[model samples]
Structures are given as C-alpha cells and as structure tokens.
Target: MIPKYRKQFNKEFSDEKYSQLKGILAKKGGIEPTFRISESPIFLTKEFESKLIDASESIISQIKTLPAEILQKAIPDNCRVPNDTDKPHFFTIDFGICRSENGAIEPQLIELQAFPSLYAFQKVYEETYCEVYPFLSEIRNPMSHETFKNHLKELIVGDENPENVILLEIFPEKQKTAIDFSLTEKLLGIKTVCLTKVKKEGLKLYYENDEKHTEIKRIYNRVIFDELDNIPDLKTEFDFREEVDVKWITHPNWFFKISKFLLPLLKHQFVPKSYFLHEFPEHESLENFVLKPLFSFAGSGVNLNPTIEITSAIKDKENYILQRKVNYEPLFEDINREFSKAEIRLLYIWRENDEYPILLENLGRMTKAAMVNVDFNKKDAIWIGSSNAFFG
Candidate 1:
C-alpha cells in the first residue's frame, strides 16, 4: 500500500464526500449496495503488485499440475454437476497482505474460487471512487473498464443473444450482492433468473422472458452447492446434476474442484500450511490453526481459535480443513491513524483455450474484525468494508 496516497485521501476525506460517493453509486446501479463500500481504495506500488502476481501465478501453476483423480475427488458424489467444462472460466484468488516471520511485508493466500465474483460492479465502483477523488485517477486497475467489459461480454454472452444467456442464481433479487446481478444485466443485456424458475422441457431448459418462455442457451451460475443443499425442501424443475442443453459459463463443478477443497494440495510461499482434518498431525497445536468447512462461503463456519475438543467432536472430518493461521498486518491507516486488516482478491478470467487465467482487477476488503465478512466487523465501522486496489 502507498502511504502518500493513503495520507492524502484521509486528509481530504469528509462525511459529505463519502455520502456523495454512495449516492452516485446507488443512482447508477438503481440500488444502494447491501455491503458497505470502504471510504478509500488502497494504492498498491509496482513492487507489491509484482509480488501478488508472482504468488498467484505460482499457485495456479501447481493447481494445473494436480492429477485428474485428485481434482475429481474434490467434488462430492451428490454435488457432481453434469457436463462440466474442461477448465474454469472465472477464477478468483484471495490474499492477505501481511508481515512474514522475518518482519517483511508479504501476500499470504487466504482462499481461491473458480466461481464468478462481482465482475461488472467492480469496474463501476472503482471508476466512481476516482470520480469523487479527482487526484487519485492516475492509480487505476491494471485493465481498463472498457477492456474488462468487452472481455466479460465475450465470455458470458458470447456469440449467442444476451437474452438467451441468463445469470442464474437462487432468488437473486433478495441476495445482498444483487447490485452486481443488476449491473450484469444492464451491461450485458442478460436477465437474472431464479434457479427454481427454470423450466425443464425434455433435455432443454427455459425461463420466462417478458411473460413468454425463452430457451436458455447459457447459464452464468451463481448458486452455491452448500446453500442449495441446505434448502432441501425447495423444489426446482431443473437439476444441476441432470444433462441439460444449456452450456455453463464456468460450469458448476468448478465451484467444488477449485475451492478450499484444493487448498491443502497447493504449495506456495504465500500459502499457509494446510491439512485435511482426517490427515491432520496429532502433534500439531490446534491453537495455531483455524478450522474451516470446505464448502461454506463467506467465512460461514470458520473457527479462529480451535481447541482439541472441537476438532475431535466434528464427525465429518473429510468435510473440514485445519489451516495454519497467518497474522494479518493492519496495513490501511484511517483518519485517526488506526489501521485495518485487509485482504486483496485478484480476479481472473480464463478463456476457452487459454493456458492460464488472466489477472484482470482486484477486490479488496478492509476489516477491523477477526474475519473480512461484514458480520464480523463492528456495526459503526467506516474505514473497513468492501474496497478495490489501485495499482500505479
């Protein structure tokens, strides 16, 4: 993080400007973001930027070399999706910018996902930040907004009509991240359809478009298998396991294949020591590690201080992972000079024939809590919330 920009932003920051920024965002998106948008965007120096790229690329390289059987083992038997793609389309790698053992700043791996993140909203959010703060325009995302939009269109919409391509989710309008869904539709001319609303006519799928049934050619899946499993009583006409005619933009199987389920197998300087609960060493201390459910999203079932009793009590050992904790250095300083812990997620998009996912932009979060989720952050927090990184 650049101290000069941080200091300058804090000095010029006022409650009025912050309100104006939020107002503009709400008007542009037609709704206020359910998640808090941080007061500032952290500026990353070229040196720190290179380090993040190196660490991410190293982990990705190792992932590609993993055996096919090992990757198949990641998907639960019941959660296996039909017609999964050869490779994931959307990839996101999260890292906590922290101090290493030798007291040097470094990026530590937090988590990685093969599913899509706020690809559409992030571009608008970063541009709005610069619109509010004119001097900070020089520090922008590595990929321009126009380039990002075009790439997204090619991946999600493709050659097919945008109307035939749907951003599939479960009750998308009710979700906290609905702003992204709305923006996705506005930018790409696609509709966000609820999973339950998908109609299965033989092997093909269809959704109501303007009161008329329209054939679904592609699905930009946003439904989490973990969430879907919890809603057992909810019935849907189309099942993800069944062979459907529609092509999955990224494919549902990648959600399990390239998640925390694969973290234990990844070896990198940025990645912390991780072990499956069943294979955890008895000699290691539980206090130094965190217990995480492999399938849960947004830090739902993470135990910061794990005891031997808690680890022993879990009956589903295969569903859990014990990861060594990394100390997060409070990098972003607020107006009061108080620092907040931050995590930077490098968002990537891998094309159909690409050797590796291309790094596009980043989604950063500043937190004063144990985890980056809003539930863990203090209610009155200002400088800690959803943020983006500006690389110069």
Candidate 2:
C-alpha cells in the first residue's frame, strides 16, 4: 500500500462523501448491492502488482502441464457436463498480501476459479471511485475501462447477437449478486434469465422475451453446480448435463477441474501447502491447517482450526482438503488506529487463440475478521468490505 495516497484519501474521507458514493452506485448499477462496499480503495506499488502477476502465471503454467487423466479425475461423476471447452475463457485467482519468513511482504495464493466474476460491475465500481475522489483518476488502474469492456464483450457476446446471449443463473433476482446482473444487462445489452425460465424444445433451448420465444445461442453461466445438485425439488426445462444447442462461455466442467480440487497439485512459492484429507501424510500437525470442502463456494463449510478427531469423523475423506493457513498482514490503518487485512483477486481472460490467460483487472476485499467473507465481518466495522485496487 502507498502511504501518501492512503493518508491523503483518509484525510479527505467523510461520512457524507461515503453516502454520496452509495447513492451514485445505486443510480449507476440500477440497484443497491446486498453486500458491504468498503470506504476506501487500496493503492498498490508497481512492484507488488508485478509479484501478483508472476505468482498467477506460475500456477497457470503448472495447470497447463497437468495430464488429462488427472483433470478428468478432478470432476465428480455426477457433476460432469457434456461438450466442455478445452480451455477456460475466464480465471479469477485470490492472493492474500502477507509477510514472508524473511519479513519481506509478499502475496500468498488463497484460491483460484475458472469462472467469470464481476467483470461488468467492477469496472463501473472503479470508475465511480474516480468520479468521487478526483485525485484517484491520476493513478492508473490495472486495466483501462475501455479495454476491459471490450474484452468482456468479446468473451460474453462473441460474434453472436446480444439478444441471443443470456446471463444464466438460478433465481438471479433473489441472489446477493443481483446488482451485477442488472449492470451487465445495462452495459452489454444482454438479458439475465433464471434457470427455470429456459424452455427446451428437442435439442435447442429458448427463453421468452416480450411474449415471444427467443432462441438461445450462448450462455454466460453463473450457476453453481453444487447448489443446483442440492436442490432436490427444483425443476428445469433444460439440464446443464444434457447436450444443448447453446455454446457455454467458460464451460461448467472447468469449475471443478480448476478449483480447490487442483490446489494440492500446484507447486509454487506463492501457493500454500495443500493436501487432500485422504492423502495427508502422517505426523503433520493439524493445528496450523484449515479444512475446506473441495467444491464449496464463497468460503462456505470452512473450518479455520481442525483437529485430528474432526478430520477422522468425516465419511467422505476425498471431498475435503487440508490447507495451510495463511497469515494475513493487517495492512490498512484506519483513523481509529484499527487495522484490517486485505486480499486481492486477479481477474484474467483467455481468448480463443491466446497462449494462456492474461491478467486484466483486480478485485480487493478488506476485513478485520478471520476470513474475508461477509459472514465473518463485524457489522460496525469501518474501511472494511468489498473494494477495488488502484495500481501506480
């Protein structure tokens, strides 16, 4: 973090200014986000940003070298989808800023996903910050708004008509990320439709638009297969497992293949030591390790401190992973002298012809709690929540 920008921004920050920021976000996004918006954006030095990029590339290179059989084993039998793409179109890797054994600051890998994230809203969020704090515009972002928009449009819409492309999810309006869906439509001229709304006729899928059946050509999938698999009574006209006419942007199988299930296989300085519960070596202490469900989303079913008894009681040992806990440095100092830890997610996109996924933007989360998740965050906390990073 840059001390000069942090000090200047904190000096000018006010309750009234934060209120105006919220108002403008609601106006621009067409709805208030259900999650907390942080009071400040972090300023990162160029050297730190380069380290983040290097760590991500190292992990991705390892992933590319993995045997096809290994990737096939990563996906569960019940979760596989037909016609998966050979490569993922999007990648989001999270890194916690921490101090190394030598006391030098560095980034540690937290998790990585081959799924699309707030590609539309994050750009708008950063631009809105510039509008509120005019001095922030002087500091360049990781990627320009124009270039980000162009890449996002190419990935989601491709050469297909915008009308035929839909952002697919289950009960999207009821989800916490509904604000992103609304902004995606406004930015790309595409529609956001619920999973239950898709109508299937033989091999093709369609959704109603203005009381007429509109054929679906592409799907920007946001549905979590684990969540969908758990809903026993849920009904849908088309199943993701079936062979459908629409093209998937990233393909659903990549989610399982590139998630925490693959973390143990990656060998990188930035990546923490991880192992499947069933394959954990004998005599390794569990006190410094955290238990995680292999395919769970958003920090769900994570045990911060695990004991041998807790790990032994599980019936499905293969479904969980024991990861070394990361020591998050309390980097940001607030006016009250309280400190908050931060993690940055590097957002990448791999085009159809690219050699590998390229980092384009970043999303940051700050918290005073043990995890960066909202469930662990204190309600009255300041300068803590969802934020963006400005790299100089």
Candidate 3:
C-alpha cells in the first residue's frame, strides 16, 4: 500500500464519487459479490508485483515434482482412477503472501480447492471498476477483464459446444459461492446444474431441462468430493473417477498436487517452512508458526500466533500443518484508519492451446484485524476482501 496514492485519492474523494461507484456496480449486477467486496480497490507498487509473480512460480515448480501417489491418496474413491489414466482433477491453488521475519516477502500457502474459483465475477468486477472510475488516470488495470473472460471461455469450452459443457456443482444454490456459478452461467453460456439433477444413462451423463435431456460432454467441476461425501441422501448414478463421457476442467489429482502439504517441499526465499503436525521436528520454540488444516476453506481452521497447548490439542495431527507466520506489511496507506494487512490473489487461467498459465485478473483482501481471513476482519474495516486496482 502506497501512502502517496492514498492521500491523493482520499483528498479528492467525494460522496458523489462513492454514489457513482455504488450505482455502476448495482447496474452491472455486482452489488453482491459471492465473497466480500471492499469499499475501495488497492493500488500496488511494481516492485511488490514482481515479487508476487516470482513467489508463485517457485511454488508451481514444487507442485510439478510431487509424487503421483501423494495426490492419489487425497482423491475420493469415486474420483480415484482405477488402474490407468490417473490424471488429477482440475483446480487452482491460492496463496496469501506477506513479508516474513527476514525482510523478504514470501507466500503463505492458503486453501487449495478442488472446485472452480470466482473466475467469472473477477472479470466482471475489473471491468466495472475501470468503467465506473475512469477518472483515476494514474491507476491502470494490469489485465483486461474481457481478456480474462475470453480466456476462461476458451479453457472451459474449447472446440466443444458450450451446451455440452456444464459447470458442475452440488446444490449450487445452497453453496456459499453460488454467485460465482451464476456469473459463470451468464458469461460462458453454460448451465450451472446440481449433481443430483444429472441423469446417467449408459456411459453418458445428461441433464433434463424443460422436458428435454441434453447430453453432457464436459464438466467444469466445482464439487468438492470431500464435502459431497458428507451428504448421504444426495444420489448420482455415475462416479467422477470412473470412465465417463465428459472431460474435467481440472482433473481431481491436481488438487492434491498443489496443496499446503507441498509447501515444505518447495525451495524459495518467499515461502515459509511448513510440515505436517505429526511430523514436526523437536524445536526450542513453537511460537514462530501457525497451525492450519490440510483441507479447509476461507481460513476455517488456521491458528495464528499458535501456542504449545494449541498444537497439543490437535487430535488429527495428520490433517494439521504448522507453518511459519509471515508478517503482513500493510501496503495501502491512504485510508485514515488503523493499519490493515492484505493478500493479493493473482487469478490465472490455462486455456486449451496455452502452454503456460495466463495471469488473467486479481482480487485483493485487506484486514484491519490481526489476520486476513474473515474471522479477523472488523465490521467497518476499510478495503478488506475486495477487488484491487493493480497499477501497471
């Protein structure tokens, strides 16, 4: 967070400008972002941006070397490969970085999900930000929202018909991120259907709509197999791992491939040393680390500023990890309030023809509390969990 930009923006800020922002967002149907949208977009320095990219590359390389067996153990039986074609499911790894004890900035591995992120809404949010606040001449978007949208379309649809590809989720309406599914449906022209609604006849999967059943050729999976396994009554005929007619956007195995468990395996100045709680080495001090669950969303089971008693209380040591805590240097300096730490989520999409991951859009999260998760955020805090203005 740069202080100069904040001062200037705050000095020029007016009630009229805020009104205009709210009106534009409302018109674009972004009044309710599935996740929280902050009051303002954050501006980043070029130096910080480069470090973020380098840290991401470092983690991705570590993900490449992970053994297939490590990943196989995490996949559910329904999604596990039988004897061949043991490909992973489609998913992305999100990292929250902060400056560590050494003065260098490193990434704190956050949740690794086996489901689609807020890909569609992020594109829309960026576009609407630029359109609504065009007067901010110094601020420029790093990636165009249109390009991100097209990139997602290409990745999800490719040469196949959009009708054949359904963005699959479980009781999508009941999901906390249902807004993202709704946005994906509006932009990609793909149906967002529940898993229970899918009809499996023979080796093919189809969904009936308006008295007609359409064949499913590809699945942009958003179901978390771990969560799905908890619900007993939900019935679906086909198993995700078994041979089926549809292809996965991200095969299930990649979820385990790029997880928090891989953090200790990566070698980088920006990553903190992480290890399974059960395998923790005897140390003189345990206060330097934080405890996190292997698979949880939105920082559900992370214990920041951990103590020895806290570590001992963990019943499932195998499912927990102890990661060194990184001090988040509050970067945004303009708001006249308490200091808030932030994490930038660089959204990347790999299309069909693309060999490398394309950095599409970004979402920034700010927290006035001690941590970045919703648990630590204050009710009236400024700029927590919102899209940011990454100056190029």
RMSD values for the candidates in order, in angstroms, are 1.1, 1.1, 3.0
Clashes of each: 0, 0, 13
The alpha-carbon root-mean-square deviation between model 1 and the true structure, to one decimal in Å, is 1.1
**Per-residue alpha-carbon lDDT of candidate 3 for residues 297-317, written as tens digits (9 for 90 to 100):** 567778887787888888988
Tens-digit lDDT track of model 1 for 113-199:
999998888888888998999888877775777788899999999999988999999988889899999888888999999999999
Per-residue CA lDDT of model 2 for 156-268, tens digit only, reads: 99999999999999999898888889998988899999999999999999999878799999999999976897877999988888988889988999999889998899888
CA displacement after TM-score superposition, residue 60 of candidate 2 (Å): 0.9
Following a full C-alpha superposition, what root-mean-square deviation does model 2 have from the true structure?
1.1
**TM-score of each prediction:** 0.98, 0.98, 0.87
Worst 10 residues of 3 by lDDT: 82-91
Q: Is candidate 1 or candidate 3 better by lDDT?
A: 1
Local distance difference test, each candidate = 0.88, 0.88, 0.67
Off by over 4 Å in 1: none
Clashes (candidate 3): 13
